[model samples]
Target: MIRVAVVDDEPVVRTGLRVILGSAQDITVVADCAGVGAVEAVRDGRVDVLLLDIRMPVVDGPAVLRQVAALPRPPAVAMLTTFDAREHVDEALRLGAAGFLMKNTAPEQLIDAVRALAAGRRVLAPEAVGQVIDGYLLSGRDEDAVRRVRALTDRERQVLALVGAGLSNRAIAGRLHLAHGTVKDHVSAVLAKLGGLNRVQAAVVADRANMVGTGPGRR
Candidate 1:
């Protein structure tokens, strides 16, 4: 089962997430807490995914994410917020958040996000993806970033583009008509070539370099 922890200052939101996620056969709501309680939850080492509210009373979601990053085995975090401000999105991603989900995200999508994160895939709400793309474009592409991406082989570049589009290895395989294992190899090669810690970090690099068309609204 995929163990999940819900961290939100609002009791109602916490309870609602627990209820929604608990219904999934493959997911279990292991802990539900306010901002402060989130520390213990992360330290417990039982959670596979953490659904963290972006704004909280004393300790905010970003601060909590920073703290979790110091842990030996931090859970994959997905920031939940009503706002899609560029700073919030960028900061959370820099702090190692695996996903950025809107508070009003559909119940099934939220569940799917948790599963995706648990399976080591990055997830982003459509608007969040747009924000990342826009922010990168507005800031102008880094020449070094472009050079780094251009160094990749043709196939690796294809894989990196899909990774930037937030497609998991399996999804990229399906899209590229390659075997799952082959996609995994390409993903590893992409990471090694890009010098990224994970898929999310690599996606950020690709975005900054404007390496791929992230679809319709991205430009």
Candidate 2:
């Protein structure tokens, strides 16, 4: 079974998530806790996926994540968000979260996201990612990050943006119309150029650099 922990301040939100995730036979809600208990829940419960809320009254998502990231084996973490908390999400992204999930996401989609995350994959749709990245770019400029990203080649920048969006090699290949193997190569090169940070960390850099690509979802 895939173990999942839900961290939210709202009791109703936690309960609602438990019900929704419970419907999946292969996925289990190991612990439904508040941000205060986030680390303890994951550590004690042997969680495989963590659904974290960034808007808690105390003990924010990124703060909890800092503790979790120090664990020998932290579960895949997807921030529980409502789309308006871009800055908070970006902060978490730099600290290394798997991705973000909309609070109002459909039950089926949420289950799928859990399953995918448990399998060590990202959950955002490539098409939808572009618009969110655009938001990050518009939020403000990170001149230092932009300079770091500017050192990359144009194609590398595209690959970096897709990676920042939490896309896998296959999805990125599809998005860029390149072969899967080639995408893997680009990923390796991108990491190398970014001083050998992991994909999610590199994503944070890409985010600050404002290089995450745009999509049709943008108005």
Model number with the top lDDT: 1
Against the reference, the lDDT scores of all candidates come to: 0.79, 0.77
lDDT of 1 at 101: 81
Q: For candidate 2, lDDT tens digit of each residue in 84-129?
A: 6655755676677776777777899899889989988766533335
Worst lDDT run of 10 residues, candidate 1, spans: 134-143
Summarize candidate 1's per-residue lDDT along 1-219 as a digit string, tens digits.
999999999989888898899889999998999999898987979899999987787998889999998999999999887644554555676688888788778899989999999988788776466655544445454345557788888888778877887777887888888999999998898888765646666776776666657422343
Model 1 quality (TM-score): 0.83
Highest-scoring model, TM-score: 1
| RMSD per model, one decimal | 3.5, 4.3
Positional deviation of residue 212's Cα in model 1 after best superposition, in angstroms: 4.1
> Candidate 2, which segments miss by more than 4 Å at Cα?
83-87, 123-141, 164-166, 175-178, 195-219
| Candidate 1 segments exceeding 4 Å error | 133-143, 208-219
**Model 2: colliding residue pairs:** none
